[model samples]
Target: MTATILLTPAVEERAPCTLPPRLVLAPGETTPVLIDGAWWPRSRDLTAELPALIEILDPLWGRITRVTVNPTFWPVIPRKVPVRGHVVHVGWFEAEQDPHKLLLLSYTVGRWDLLVIPPETEPAIAARLMATATDPSRSLTATGLIHEAERFRITAEEAVGSDSLREAVWDSEGGNDARRPASHASAGAVIDHVPSPAEGR
Candidate 1:
């Protein structure tokens, strides 16, 4: 009897990636902000955590694209921290019934910062919204959001804080800044929405 020769095909081993996967998610209200990787755990409860988030988040309620209270992962985001003061609130204000611009107001124990994001549709309106958010005389309730389908909506039960709360990230350092100021500024404006090269696999 002649025995046939058998050969086993070699399995190619995958190389370990040196760089971490870039975080990506289209801006919108949703669960588990990070798309391709692990950030928030599957075992945690969002309902039990909602109240504390609002208490800590205080006045930062608006069109929140993403939020997580007491997240359990090292977020891959470039953020200025409490050293400058954490971002306390983020949302987009309305402009002549259209989504205008993003108004982000950050605060600390004794400090506050106001940074504006464009496609500035109505610079005057954006300035007013910013003023409303930053005005020391205004109450948190007075700065409440307008309900629009195009914008992210936060119900009375869902307001929350931003530490470990990631609503947006960048493909590069200039992702938000590199775009032309004239680009349309919707509630969820993603000027840089392409997936990372690592995600191609």
Candidate 2:
């Protein structure tokens, strides 16, 4: 019997993600910033990540808008760095109920969301969120993040302009839809180098 040799196909390396110009930070910056519903990854901690992030999103959060982070941000190591604005009155929603995990910023500039999706599924879920933030007409029941989102939410008072976002995952009934089950008990955002009150502005 003669045996035939088979060639194996080499796996191609994924290209570097081309982030939007605005999303690109200076020499050093932390990332995985959930911008306009898209996620941008960075390789380092930034000197002024928040200001730079807000600057890129100026059209949405504006220069002087009051931005509040969930209390979960405080009480962490490094002794509680300060933010541009104060913390919200009501505490954060349980992980089983928060709308977004990257950041729970409360801004009054306006509800703004933009999405540019590639062929990947995770990005598409993020894009769908951005799309839903600005437009309530779109339903997110079909989006990939709904199952995870169903278990995380903010308070009624802190959930301004997020009614649609809260409802998008209602269909999940707090259970997995199709993807692998997600870990839900991780701590909230840990944005390093966020300028202290005196250091910033």
lDDT of 1 at 200: 35
TM-score of model 2 relative to the true fold? 0.28
Q: For each candidate, what is the lDDT?
A: 0.26, 0.32
Instruction: Give the runs in model 2 whose Cα sits over 4 Å from its true position.
Output: 1-49, 59-61, 71-121, 138-201
**Tens digit of per-residue lDDT, candidate 1, span 46-81:** 222222332333444332223312122111211111
lDDT of 2 at 86: 28
Every model's Cα RMSD, please?
Answer: 25.0, 24.3
lDDT of 2: 0.32
Q: Per-residue CA lDDT of candidate 2, range 1-201, in tens? A: 111211221111212223433232111132322233532323211112233344455544553333322223222111112223421112233343233233324455443222322223344344444444334333342223445333343333334434443333432333334352344312112222333335544
Backbone atom clashes (below 3 Å) for every candidate: 2, 7
